[model samples]
Structure formats: C-alpha cells, structure tokens
Target: MKKSFLILVVLLISGMMSAQNGGNDMKKFESQLPQEGRGNVRVAYQGKAIDQMIYEFMEEQGIPGMTLAIVQAPYIPRIVGYGVTDIEKGNLAAAKTLWPIGPISQGFTAVAIMQLYEKGKLDLNDPIGKYLKEIPEPWKSISILQLMQHSSGIADYREQKAFDVSANYQPEQLVQMVATLPLAFDAGTDVKQSATNFLLLTSIIEKVAKMPYHDFVKKHQIDYLGLKQTYFGEDIPNVKQEDVTTTANVHQTFKKDKDYINPSETTTGYVEKEGKLVVAPTISPTSLKGFADIWASAENVSHWDIGLAGSVLIEKPENRDIIYKPTKLANGKTVPAMAGWQFYNHKGLMDIKGNVSGHSAFLSRFTDASELVCVTLLANKEGVDLTNLGRKIAAAFDSSKMGTGANDDLLYTYESLFSVDETMSKIEKVLKTMGIPVFAKFDHGKNAEEVGLKLRPNQVIVFGSPKVGTALMQENPSISIELPLKISVWEDKNGSVWASFPQMNLMAAEYDMESNPVIGKMQELLEKIVIKAASQY
Candidate 1:
C-alpha cells in the first residue's frame, strides 16, 4: 500500500513539470532502499513511474524534471522519482542521474574545511581573501562563522545586476565577485544570504588541502563511505554502473549560453554554442535561479548518503550504528559528524554550470524521527519556483509536533496582522490554516491570573516606520488594509523582555520591500504597533 502511494506522489510532481515547458518530461520516483542509506540511512519506502503522483504533481505544475529520495531507519533508501528531463522531448528521468547540487554543494566544501579543521591546517575564522590572493577588490575580514551563518554583510551573488549567466569563471573569478564588495554589515552584526561565501570556500578547500576541492571530498568521504557512484561534477570517478545510471535522456550538451561557464569548468562538457572554445562554469546572478530539471537515482541517495557525501551530519556517530565508516582524521582521531538544527538540517538549490549547472536540488534530515529526504530537480532552463515544491516534499517529515523552535519569539507572539478582536477570534482559524493540528485554549491575559500566562519581553517582529503604505495609496489606498505594521507580543520572566520577529514579512506580497516609501512605512508602522502592543497588549 505504501509503495503504491509513493508512486502516486512521484506522478504528481512530473505532471507539474509538463505544464511549464509544454514538453512531456517523464519522471521516476523511488521509495524504500537498503537499510542504512550506504549503511546508516535506513529506507522507509520506495516508488517510481512516469505517471506517479509525485511526477504528476511536478508535470502538471509545469516542472521540467525532479528527483526525490527519502530514508527511514532500518529500511532501504527510497528513490522517489526522476521526473521528465525535458518537456519537449518526453525524456524520462531516473535515480542516480547526476544533477548539480547547487548550494548543498556548500556542504561538501564545509566538510572539506572541517576535515582541514581536524588537521589544523586552516581556521574557520580566517579571512577568506587570505587564501585566494588574486581576487581584485578586497573586503574586510569575514570569519568562517560569518560565511557559515550568512551573517556577513557581503552583497549576494544574486543581488549583483551586472553579472552574466553564460560567462565562465575560474575559482579565482568566483572570489573576485566579492573581492571588493563592501561588507553588508560587520561580519557578525547582520544576516544576509549569499553564494559568494561558498564559492570562496570551495577555493579555500583547494588552497588548504593542496588537492582540488572535489578531489579531496572524493578521496576522503564518498570513497570512504563506499558511495562508489556518488561524485561531485566530474571529480568523482570509479563508480559502479548500477550505482550511477539514469535513463533521463536530456542532452548532455545544449545550446550553451556564452557566459554560462567561463572561468570554472565542470566535468560535464560545456562548450561555447557559437564556437568550440572551452571555459569553466562561472556563477553569475543570472544563473543562480537554477535550471528546471534535476537528476539522481536512489542507489546512493538517502539522507545517509547526504550525511556522508555532503555536509557534516549525525554529529553523534556514537548515536548511530553503521557497518561501514569513513577514515579517521589525519590525526588518527575519529571526527564526529556534528548535527545542526536538530530536526531539519538545511536544503539548497544550485544552477548548472561546470559540475554545478542545470540542476536544482534540496537536502533535509528529520533528526528526531531518524528520517531524511533529498530531491534534485535538474533541467537546462532556470527557474526560481522549485523551492516552493521542495518544501511540500520536506513537510512530510518536518514533524509539526516539534514546531520550528528557531526563534522562540515567533512561536509566542500574538500580535500578528489583523485587529485585536478579529485576531483573537481567528487564533483557532490560523492554527487550522497552518496544516499542523494545533489546539489553543484561549486564555486571555487580563488579570493577575492571566498575566502569569503571558510571556513578557515579547518576540517582536518589528519594522521601523509606518509610512510605507501611504505611497501604496498612490497605487491603491485599500493597501492600508494590509498595513505594514509591527507584530510583537511580550514575554516576561520577572520584568525582563526579549525580542523576535518573522522574516516572511520582508518578502510578503502586501509590502514592496524594494520600494523605500513602502519600506519606511513598514518600519514606522511596525515600530509603532510593536511599542503599543508591548505596553498595553
């Protein structure tokens, strides 16, 4: 019964792909695999097919192609589906099909860095430019933590407007993009996401290890883990055919974009569409959006393989029982694969360029449930909507009972949008809308008894001004209905207070974050609302 249900899920994803490309891209979804994905990742279920539910979702939704792999302990890793490779060709996708892993590739570099850390060759807190000297414009020191946490003020790769997608880049070229970028904020003071850090990290991996970045991972992790078929771009070799076969027939080469990859090249062949000259894939803002297609087979794809092949996971190896294990650190000490973000680790999407383009992907691990999931959506065209779909797949194991506990402030806040009366009435409504089953016995905090229940020093999702929406009045005054106001509620341990807020507001539809007037109003309204709510709310 579960197998049948799994097939249904794959078909849905494939169907979604067909709508956008107007091409018949077939998909394959697999569930259930050898227990301990490569050993430690057990498979819970497996499924695959052209019209499977997962594929159908992707196909009908206009997704070009996609792959889903999941694992539950003591079971074989599930190979969800490699939905269509091309919409026009009706090409089917298969498990183990190589798709560029995008940002999750960041995990590989991070691991390689950690391995170096174990060796004591480099410091995670070291300035990135120190490793790559040729970068043109230099910025202030950005600690490894800043890069890892996205706290560095460096402008993002996607934020730059002049970048060219088809242009190739050497690793040095990747470094140059941010060589001169002014720190977005002091390294630790702010948080902003950027791909430049990882690209630079890739370079650091090479500089410190002396071997190419991909080579170090292949020798140290993939090979040691016995993920014979798993490799990054062309650097991985010596794979068993069964381990890496994909029936997805997307052309290995395509109408190449001139700037697609210039400075840094991948193992995959990418030549100039206009000429035979070769260049490495250069990451540019244009290419970050990612291709619509993804590739990978279930053979080596499980959360376990992700743990071994990509970033550090399962910090407590002592917590797991696996038959095979990677080699000890150069110091002859076993390095613990420290876990991060207990329930959900992190997922990333990357565009194809060198070993990196035409592939959109994700990685997730439900640590407490001992479940892990990964999906790769590979195609020749770029798309940004891929994450919307990945999240749905991840939601399956997200364990709603756990409630994302990242910012406690967000979890406890009561003053979101809407009026006090309407908001209070809608608590049950909002909880129901969240999909996760929730029960909130409304206990208004009024008198002494009620006051005890209220958490003081609230988590306030604050904005600086109330004027952003006034300009929207120029476009339409009703916009005020969704005014850019602060959403804050306090929690007090004694009389002390704490603050927290939602990030979604920055990207919400009602507020145009890019527009200064809108942003200012939001800041004003958010602060005013937050202050008012905190004092009397």
Candidate 2:
C-alpha cells in the first residue's frame, strides 16, 4: 500500500508540472531528477534540477514533512510537499495543507502597520504614546517606526525562562512580563528581535483601527487578498475542508495521494527529543499575538507575499520599504535586517525564519534579482536552519546569479546532494567528462572498517590536468607535491555531505606564484568540477 501510494503521489506531481510548464518542459524537468522526486520539481530556467537535492536534504535533516513554494515574481511555478505530515496518523503533507509559519507572521503584522500609515490613520514617525496610553513612558517615547523596525530595544517576553508557550497569556500580561526589564539597548540605538515590540504594535493597531488586531488584519490583508488558507494560531482547529483552498487550484503534489484525508488540519509539528522525533507541545495563540501566531499553507504564504510586493497590500513602495529595508540605528549605522528579516549579499534578497513550538518556517524573497524568486519552506521539525537550503533551491532556478557557489560561504566547500560515495562518483564522472585523468581514489570509511575500526562516510578523489600541473610545476617545483588536485567528500555527524578542496589562489600564494595568470584558470576549472559534481545547480 505504501509503495502504491508513493507512486500515485509522483504521478500527481507530474500532472502538476505539466499543468504549469507544458508537457515538454515537464518531461525535461523530470529527466533531470531522481525517481523519488522526478515529478515533484519544476525548474523555470535552464540549470541542473534540484528535486533530488531537496529530497536528500529532507532525509538528512530527519524532517518528517515539508512544503516548498517557489515563486517567480507574478507567478508561482509550483508548491511541492514531501514526507508524511502526521507520522502516527500517516497523513502525507500537501501544498494546501496548513502549517504554522512562525516569525514569518511578523511580516503580516508589519504590513498591517504600514496599511494604517497609508490611510493617514497613523504616522510611522509618531510616538507610540500617541495611540496606546498604558505602555511604560520609556516604551511610549519609542516611535511607531522603531517598533516595526525592531529597533525599539524592547526585551522579548518569550525570552523569559518561566514563560509557558502552552499557557494562554493575554497580550497585556505579556507586555507586563517584560515591563520592568531594562531595554536591550537604547531605543533606535541597535536592532534586536523583541516580541514585545510587535505586541505593543498590535495594541496600537487596535487603538488606531478601533477593532481587534486579528480582525483588522483579516479585513484588510487576508480577506482582501482572498487568502482562504491563512489563520490565527487558535483558529486552525476550526478550519474546514471547504475553507481550505490551494492557491492556484492546480497543486496535486500530495493531496490526491493523501486521498484528501483530514483536509483541513494543520500539519503535525515535531521536535527532536532524546535524538528522536516527537510531537511538540502546542503554543498559545494569545502569547504569539502580533509576532508569530499566523498559520497558512506554503502556497498561500506565497500569494500574500506577492500581494506585499505590489500595491495590492501596502499600496506604496515606500511604505513597504519601511518594513523590508534595513533599520537605521541612532549611531548612524544601519542593521543588516529589520523586523524578522535578514538581508543577504544577493541583491534584494532577504529572508525571515524562526521556530514556533515544534514547527520551523522559512520565507525568502529574492526581490531584486533579474527575475524575482521567492522560496517558502514550512516544516514540522523545529530549529532546522532553512536559509542555505532555501537559497540553494532558489539558485536552482537562477544558477548564474544565485548559484550555491556564489551565495554560500567563502570557503571552497560544496554541499553534496548525495551520499559521500555518490558524491565521489559524481566527481569522478565530471573528471572523466572533462578528460582530466584521475590518478587515485581512497575510501577512508571503508579502509577503517576493513581494519576493524569505525569511521563515518568519507572519501577522497585525486584528479587533475597534467598540462596545467606541469605549467604550475615549472613555476615552482614545490607546487608539484600539491598537483593532481584532490577533493575530500565526507558526511558530517549531522548527515550533511560536503566536498572540500584547497583554494587554488591561496595555494598559488603559498608557492609565491600569485602573479601567475594560469593560476586563475586552474582555480576556475577546479570550481567548475566540484560544482558539477556536488551541486544540482
């Protein structure tokens, strides 16, 4: 039964890709993926596909279930869900299945404040005292903009050790929890994420709009955008089959395979306990108000994001900038991130990520790219870092600018989308394809096992071009020892596979051949080889 259901899920995914990209492109996309994920991925641009990459990543991370939504500006290519959402119930995750989107909810709260600013109901520069009379005088003096920017220095109520996530604390009680604590820094002097800042913003929103915070957001954002899937944390239980809608009515990634069972329930959130996955305790919706309470399907989150990117929600680019742009501190320095978002070196790329109880959520927007791409991943596992994974997925769609080689660390290390053996095999294949001779290969793990010892998966491959090596050797005979460049592939304790090689430029410097132009060519060739082997894009 499991095997039959898995095959059915793959077919539904293929159908979804066909609907989005026509039959030819869908076939080409499938041809590039592994059997398990072939039908579940769509590539908008010409590049190595990432279906297998994502599947392997989820496996390594021990993620029970996840939903990935890829947006290419005005259109979403597809939203694919993987693994079982509820292990005990055996419910497979679907694109339409709701997930609690932790700190990503702050973006919604920020937009709500931005909307009021557009309506002339409130001014960003106005002090919070203008709206809410009950906050401490110090907090009151902080401007509305500071709160939205998270530069108000307000300490987070959630940081208190005694704070109970499962308890229903009123918003006022949450504020009072941190009322007497000193600010992390002087207001607007530095930026820090504080739930208290948004909690107070919610109060001000209620005061200015004369309605409850959730209702105002519903009327202005959710209902306006026609997002049927978004809900407050406490309201998820009431979600009905009729209330649940896929963003495009085209997603069949897991729904058909799931047989439409328990159609309206939120995905079960999980946490690692004693090195095993366990259901996480429920978080109080009231405690997360104005910060991390919203729940939505990955696709709907993409739609709301699309709305935020244009006039559909905030109405003005300047108003949107007030939230997404970096925050300016009192010291005349600007923080790299604002609200819950952190900016990246990639132009116009920013992401918001956090854990809400047992669930982890990530939302990345590459707004400034040649083609705007946004990737959203909602998963059941808590505390999994999705930044690199999200960027790699986006890079699969736009390899030239967003490729993992450029977007990741400065070290010449590539994350492999396969096991150590598979990654080493790919390296050998690339070397053969390039007509570079492989002089040696070693399996450290296998050798250790043969010697009645233990070692994790590790392998090293030595391959190089003699012509290039000879030239470098002529410059310095000592360089010959370093010739026949080798890369080590290993699986870390966490199960992530990586390929590491020496930096050619740094090696050249060591040999006092820094001025050698051929050194640059050798470096580029090595990079090309590793990328082709370890990375999907």
TM-scores for every predicted model: 0.49, 0.67
Candidate 2 lDDT by residue in tens digits, 1-537: 999999999999998987877767656855567433112344522344567667866886689999999888788878888887778766678878889899899988888888888999988889998888888887888998889778898889999876888899888788888888888888888777888888888999999999999999999999998998899977876775432244443334446556345365577788988769998988877888988889899999999989878888888887778777777776797776787887644467778888888889999898874648899999999877676578678776655556544313234666565678877888888888888898999999999999999999999888877888898888799988887888888776546577777777688788999889888777668767776675431
Q: Give the clashing pairs for model 2.
A: none
lDDT tens per residue, model 1, 1-537? 999999998998877776754543221212343323234222111222223445544543344555566544434445544445434344445554555555544544555566677677887668776876765444436656456555556666645665555554454554556667677666555444566665666667788889876577677766665663355533323322221124353333223543222111112312223322233353433233211111234345453345643234324343222201221222343311211111111212111111344443445433333334444333332322343234344433342321222342222221222233333334334334433233223223443345565422232221222343455556666655544433433333322122224433443444554444444334433333333332211
Error of 2 at 148 (Å): 1.2
Instruction: Give per-residue lDDT, candidate 1, residue 118.
Output: 61
Report the poorest 10 consecutive residues by lDDT, candidate 1. 336-345
lDDT of 2: 0.79
> Which one wins on TM-score?
2
